[model samples]
Target: MSTAHNAFPSQSATGAERGALRGALRGARAYWEMQKRCAIIAGSVNVLMLVVFHIAGLDALALFSVGSIAAYALAWLCLQRRHNRLAIGLMCAETVTHAGFGFLLAGPESGSHYYLLLFFPALFLGSSPRRAMLPAAAVLAAYVALDAWVYAFGPMALISPFDQALMRHFNSAIIIGMLSYLAIYYRKRVVSSERQLRAWAGSDPLTGLANRRHMDATIRALDADRRGGELAVLMADIDHFKSINDRFGHEGGDMVLRRVAEVIQGCVRDTDHVARWGGEEFLIILSATPLHQAAETAERIRRAVERIAFDELSCEGAPLRVTLTLGVAERAGQEALQATIRKADEYLYAGKHGGRNRVCRHADDPGRRALRQG
Candidate 1:
């Protein structure tokens, strides 16, 4: 298996999922850009705060204001380095220092005076909800402890006592709101987007079944753990499809292929997948069904295709008939997925040779069993 970080960025958004894809990228980029902006905003906020502290001759507050400016610059550098861990680490460090400095320089009268809310939006993106709360709660508790420590310390003059209590309450409300909004809205959107992307990667657009790539991926991904169902694979091809194209043109051929796709879909259970393997050929992945059952299913699709009538074409001065030939084999534990597909394709060719519109077993072709599917 490839590493998680490497493969995902190359994935394309399906037509249905463009909105979610845009939203995820936009949110992440906006969050990064916002981090960069925070340096300027926090620095300005600190400079203004320094002017106020200088008037009051609160030298410690001025010291903290300068420290905050330095921390913001360090934070900016961390983000630019693409060191996500270090960047978040800097943010956490700054959160602690700002809260502590507030308590040290001001007192409980100021509480956690350094805008604690600034970090919460970014936190919503970084970690899972269960894990995020741990960090957020840690930050909040640090602020509370610092406030308590300040209250126990010597006299200090800053915000009125009533204003301090009100600020602390407001901080608590904002934190709670952040938690609620992220859990209900942002997280749901992320999950929905992920599901849609998975479906896009897994499905064949023409027939709404697993694509060839998806079948290969799925085969490699199945675990060696307990499995109750027997496995069977069927490789199917539309009989005389090329002649149909020559006789009725490509559009009719496409229509016939589509109708055959519907017929194949109708023949199998929802659990099974019938993929358009390529032009006029399909790959059917079966679960719970053994070789014989898979063969029967393939025959059902064959008969369905043979019986389908393109009546609208009759009205248009031309009609078409389509039929399918299939090859079925059980998935042996010793055989790889591609190898099985090759085996099925050999039997499928045998069916076409012997007489189109029949099911053949790969074991019938002792010579071609070792051959590859093209």
Candidate 2:
């Protein structure tokens, strides 16, 4: 079996699920980007707060802002050196400490609790969901402790009602902005990962052709559309593929498959669909084509395969040669898609048995008639 089959299973149900899982969980690299953004935004916000508090003559709050700025600056340095864990620790500690000071000095009316809420989503940006749980629990414990402290004692300092409302609004805006950034970035990562996973699922890894499952879906979709156009199927097999594998081993066989697939693709138009059906066999769908035209195409493909020189592959000092036998069948009006494909497969084997490196169409086909007479 080709490595392609092992890489993407022909089973549709399992493949879809596996693809989704791989896509969803593959955002570890994006985490660092999120971390950097968070650090810059946090550091900037605290710098602004430092100026604002100093102007308002709140010396203690201004001092806390300096500490927040230093923490975030260190976090940025840690990130530069790729010390991600230390950076995350510094940022989390700074955020919790800042929120604690805000509530102690200016009270819960200042909406400092909103700052603490950032931890839930921020922690999830680190690595896997399971690993994020410990930090998430720690944040939860801190939140509960902060709430208990507020219940036991009130604010130690007082500020104007207008000042309290402004701080509340400012903190609310910051949390909202940060959360929105995380959401958008997370979505982009998931979407890109899913697209890549889907491509892998539908493609043959070795030849980069549509795999069997994807081809089957394409056929079914055409059947459902019921557009009044005739489509033709060509089932082609590499001539003496097993012998080639036996002579040159699986690696050489894989190379031949990829080369033949490229030749077949070159012979067909972009509108046509081609897939590595399985093993050494390929299936092609020629849209709006008649049986005779498809047969001509198959013959062209056969000639192209014959022309491919495996200069690097040799057995007993003779360079390797390759050829293909193809079967052509046109879909009848209202005929089942599978029935047409089966007919193509039958013709393909007929071509193989009658003589190799031939294109077999309907019995009345002139080339097929000549083959029988010879």
Candidate 3:
């Protein structure tokens, strides 16, 4: 449990709010994953630079590179442990070390000042915007002081002309490469966020099924396409749901709803769509299915729901049983979706009044009456 839980409550008031939170978390996690990737890449690059500097006979640079490697390694370890703040601190230390080395090697004259640009992306990636501000300011101030010192007094070690030119090119290359990576990573994150936002807008948070809005949109789309054979709609209501909630708390009610959703989804075909219409009620849209077949599917769902013991969810040792009444209706000619749903709803009410745990379809009404008489 964390802030995510508070933002994404188990019992959300509206589907839109729940969907928005899910989308936000998806976007946030993607950015976090990118930051972790950046840390690993930075660590590997530091190790490679350490070896290169060591071979080039640059003692001071090599020693600083060794410290940089250690700092990045520790940062990486912290990330593995899920200690993001510690990893950010280590990355800051690594940045400072890199600046110090820049001063010791060739200072401002060799374009070592360009290395400061690296801190911007690294700091932003590793920390939140509010938290990154202070560290970014401090790093910038330190780099400015170092640059002023180098300009006023000159570099400590007098490196050869060839080494100065090489250092300048190398530092420039690193900055360009890092900038390229940041641009691509940010772009990809934006795209992913947009996609998740769309999905959340259409999805129900509790059961991960299509929300009412999405279902409506889908039905409208299907209705527009008249080429389809036939469509059947089933309206299902859990029986004695309030009593279940009364006996077992709201948490238990939530669990039962989720279980019912799963059972209905498992009973339906892949082409069929299931949605949580509202509290304790679900709607199923079966493509190319007639009323009779849809009734069979509803019966299957009813049986599956009845079989659920809900042992884990029960407060007492006794097992809990839940039942549902389903009504099936098929779309006729160019009939409106809402009209068909109304027909289904009428049948569902009839079944609920007659007896719970039964499937009622237009064709089965007479047979049910005869059976009752017999």
Candidate 4:
């Protein structure tokens, strides 16, 4: 690989981060997986509550913890079966029921109402905001009703101040832990989404090379910062591409395009910018390189392409062969980048009209010279 600095940002990540991002990319299914994880966490919290309440001789609350754990297990099973809607509905039911129990029996100091807030963002995970609205409003209504009931009648059962405070802190920690996990999950999703958007915006879908728009941007950036070094551009076109498409069909044509892109990419240094400049044309930009070196690179690409045997894309009894016609141009002092590109295009056509599988570097390039002599 040529060790040239790339104009685009790298999308590399650690294995764990990549896994998280990949999970995020799965949309609703990923959300369901996240919901299952939430269920497991909440169940674990209920187990702890079950132990604490049982030890404290709070039989009602301890019995309620057992029921909550069972509900969470059911929700987890629903998620496992891919019944996301049912699973989320079950979770919502458990949240409201548990919150009501805590407020009515254990009192407001227990902080169980915070559990109601967990599903607000979670509601949007498996659904659109509009679809999630009613459920979210129901959660809000439940919270409001619980608050009003507590204001009027107060706690139905009284516990020691010490036990109340301990429960309050325990509930707070659980909710806080859940919220922190959600924040991290959402952040990973956003990062993964941005990376995908960037790739779709900048790359060609068929060839996986930089598209014309990206190449234009790279050219402008390079021109603005010439760094007192030479810049070379090569415009290449597959010889008789339309004929190939006619013979082999679009799928075969696509395979050829992808293969040619790979070969061209391999011929250039890592820092060099290569783009699919629409249809069968490709553009390359070499930084800190002079005309001769660029011409040599173009010749190398031409030879490489010419030797490509399409073993899998045979015509009759023989394998298919492909070739490239390339034009090389170096950016002149203070010359507009577009002008250099046009010069390259002109030379590319010169190579095309002269014969086919050759590289043209100048007005007096061998292909053009041969044509003139002819």
In candidate 3, what are the lDDT values of residues 1-374, reduced to their tens digit?
A: 01012123344566666666777776667766766776777767667666655655567777777777777778778878889889877776676767676665666656656767877876676569999899789878888888778878888888777777766677677778878988898898889778777787777778788878899998898878878788899999988887777777777887888888988889988988898787788889899998778888888998999999998765466788888888889999899878888888877876776677888887467534654555
Write model 1 residue lDDT over 214-252, tens digit each, in one string: 877766654242273677888888876666667666666
TM-score of 4: 0.83
TM-score of every candidate relative to the true structure: 0.53, 0.82, 0.81, 0.83
Check candidate 4 and list the clashing pairs. 2-269, 2-270, 4-271
Winner by TM-score between candidate 3 and candidate 1: 3
| Residue 203 accuracy (lDDT) in model 4 | 77
User: Candidate 4: where is the Cα deviation over 4 Å?
Assistant: 1-25, 47-59, 66-74, 77-81, 144-154, 369-374
lDDT of 4 by residue, 242-346 (tens): 778788876777788889999999999998999988778899988888999999999999999988999988888889999899999999998888899998988
- Let me know the TM-score candidate 2 reaches against the reference structure: 0.82
C-alpha lDDT of all candidate models, in order? 0.67, 0.82, 0.77, 0.82
Candidate 2 C-alpha lDDT tens digits along 13-93: 555666667655566557877788789889899887887767656679889998898888899889889998899889988
